[model samples]
Target chain A: MADLRINLAGISSPNPFWLASAPPTNTGYQVQRAFEAGWGGAVWKTLGDPIINTSSRFAAVHFNGQRVAGFNNIELITDRPLEVNLKEIAETKKRFPNHAVVVSLMVEPKREKWHEIVKRVEAVGVDGLELNFGCPHGMAERGMGSASGQQPDLVEAQTMWVKEAAQTPVIVKLTPNITDITMTAIAAARGGADAISLINTINSLAGVDLDSWNTIPHVGGKGAHGGYCGPAVKPIALNMVAECARSPHIHIPISGIGGISNWKDAAEFMLMGATGVQICTAAMHHGFRIVEDMIDGLNNYLDDKGLASVSELIGKSVPRYSDWGDLDLNYQVVARIHEDNCIVCNKCHIACEDTSHQCIERLETSDGRSYLKVREEDCVGCNLCAIVCPVEDAITMVEIPSTELPMSWNQRQKAIGSMGQNEAPGAKEAV
Target chain B: MSDYGLFQEEKNRLDAYISRQFKIVGITENLSGATVELEHPGGGQAEVRLLTAEGRKYMSNLVIKQFTAAN
Candidate 1:
């Protein structure tokens, strides 16, 4: 079997999968059960001043027939007392000595409070500490979670305070509510964070009850915005991870979170620069046993890829991700319909004729049967026709080799600027 | 006519100028399209407006080739 073990900035785990600091890691019992079920690590739920939670604190966005395609929560940090949580952490560590147990912390942004909490949590013999700067709903109202997280200076100061007393590696879990995530990531690194994790859920509301005219998961007939997570937010989260991963200033191991459901998502995050992945929504929807399939699938994938360790996947695709200006403008792909695989469904033709460039033409064959063909010269290769095709391999995007030298938009602009006076002969008359 | 036909017509116009020993002097691009200024050694000048993407790409290729050859 390929080695699945990973060490994220010195916090070693049996595998790259860790339970995010969410409801699943709220208690030692749940975390112990998760570890027993084959999770490599767990970031214990954010522990600080205990706060009472409401009854209807959770809601889900179910897309089409998929259940819990996206999950939203207004749930706050651990409601249990600090002593109780600390005792559980110490006990859990003693039990799962080899498993990684990182405690997430959040308190008033004060130096003493940070020092005291860091010292107390580290005293429990935990493997690491994740500064929770990303709870975006209830605690944010009190200027604690996303409130402190939104400000780059606050993130840096608070992280610095935690690092002052933290013996264990400190990971600053970033909030995605900001305009640019790299701003806070760079702040965390400046504060001497050992590693960083993102993205803590985006601000979202699940939906409204059209019949009742009330919001979904309304507590006492009222609703507030919640933090959004789940498969629906994967693309957004992946882009943020890629943005931070490709940044030059932010150099820290990333513990990628947000909508990581299965092994494929985990591998994608790792390839994009996450050293380890913390998952919650999938575990919450399917229970802790889902990690079994994740572990097995990842093991099989690594072995098939001829990689000896899961760590080999980290940051492998970062070089492939670049700005739009760097992409070659000369490269082209045109849609080609395979006649054998075509289902004779007019979805591609209709999509092309109406929304896209009028390229795919509907024509009768020699036998008077209908078929579609693409006018290659006019087809812009937007991939809309292929996307709407129901049958697999019916419409394929084939790359067209260019005869000219490869050029990028940046290069093209530079070349245009090099030519001095570009004023047309009849430009004044045309204007 | 299709866009390809327009591009072919414009490409032929450019090729006609090139066959007459006309050298590209100046080029301009705007919302309308790219306009190439060609001048022959015998003191004749002509301009062609390329509206299609292929035509513009063809013009850009020529400009890049001239730039590379000059350097």
Candidate 2:
């Protein structure tokens, strides 16, 4: 396998995959097990002055047959005492020197509090510090988390304050609930953050229990919107990461987060300009062992693609993305169905007849028999019916264009026709 | 609505060239929207239908299905 080692601002890791600061990284025990399982690094769960957590702090959304999505907590940062967390950081760093152990912090929005936290954490041999300026729920009500990140001036001031007191590298994690990600990223950069990580979950209200007239994960029959993360947020995270990477003002190192479940996802974040990829939901969903696949898959993919190093793939796709209207206008494809395999279900027929292009043609035999037919001119190439069909490979999309004329296999064979029906593949039946 | 009107209004435009392009009989086709169905010359049936609501327009993309009888 090709080399997967990466160095972000002098903090090196065996690979670019790191655990995001969430439940999985809430303690040193969890983090050590994660490293032993092959994760290259981890951001210790957000730590600050101890705070209370509610008993039932979660909700979910289901789609199709899966619990497709969810939300988290009335919980605050790591509830463990600061000294205990510090002692673990020192031990974790001493035990695994190669892995990146960046301490994530959030406290009262005071420069003195940030200054003290950075100084104390730096002494633990930690590789870096991530400002937890993006937690959207309980913490924000106290003028921390999203409160600090939302105001550009506060983002800059708080980042600058920590940078001033820190010896270790500082990364500012941004919230997705903001208006423009670029504006916040620029603010972080201007404050001298060594790098930026994003996004901390989006604000969400999971769902409602209509009879009780209360929101889910309800406490006292009422619930507030919580921060949303998991697979559902990956696209939004990717878009924000891309915006930061492409933004002219901020070109610092990036640790991408949001719904990264496997190596392919980590690789996409790298290609979009993140030097490292941080994951939370996946680790929560499948347990820490997933890092084994993440490491193996990325390494194998690199070897197959002939890339000798992880850095080779970083930000590679950034240049290909451009403003809208620059896309090619002539590309086209047609919808084609396999005849011998069709089940003759008329669901597509009824759907198309009443609601769509009215492009379907039903025909009867010369003896007054009937079947379905397609009017090619009106078919717009939507693959919806294909998705709803139960048969496998029965329907497929085939591309055709106005510029290219049609070709008939029978006509070509007829033009070269000298062979009688007696010797062909179906000749016996014809006779 | 008349099923025959739907078929003729949909297929009349493609009558001249479709048989040459795809070796199939035009069964029911709607070019204006997602409701179109066709049978390939090889005897497979294809159908198109609408699935979701479209924004800023009267239609969204069509769902196309192909089928053959199961034994």
Candidates' TM-scores? 0.95, 0.74
Put down candidate 1 lDDT per residue, A336-413, tens digits, no spaces: 999999978899999988888889999998999999999999988899999999999998999999988887777766
**Model 2 agreement with the true structure over A38-135: per-residue lDDT tens digits:** 98999999989988887678766666766646445555688889999999889998999999999899987789999998899898899999999999
Query: In angstroms, how far off is A28's CA in candidate 2?
Result: 1.0
Can you give the lDDT of residue A128 in candidate 1?
98
Cα lDDT of candidate 2 equals: 0.75
Best by DockQ: 1
Best-fitting candidate, scored by lDDT: 1
For model 1, what is the error of residue B36's alpha carbon versus the real structure, in angstroms, after optimal superposition? Answer: 2.9
Between which residue pairs do clashes occur in model 1? none
lDDT (CA) per prediction: 0.92, 0.75
* Isolated chain A TM-score, each model: 0.97, 0.84
Task: Point out where model 2 deviates above 4 Å.
Answer: A340-431, B1-71
User: After superposition on all CA atoms, how large is the RMSD of candidate 2?
Assistant: 15.0
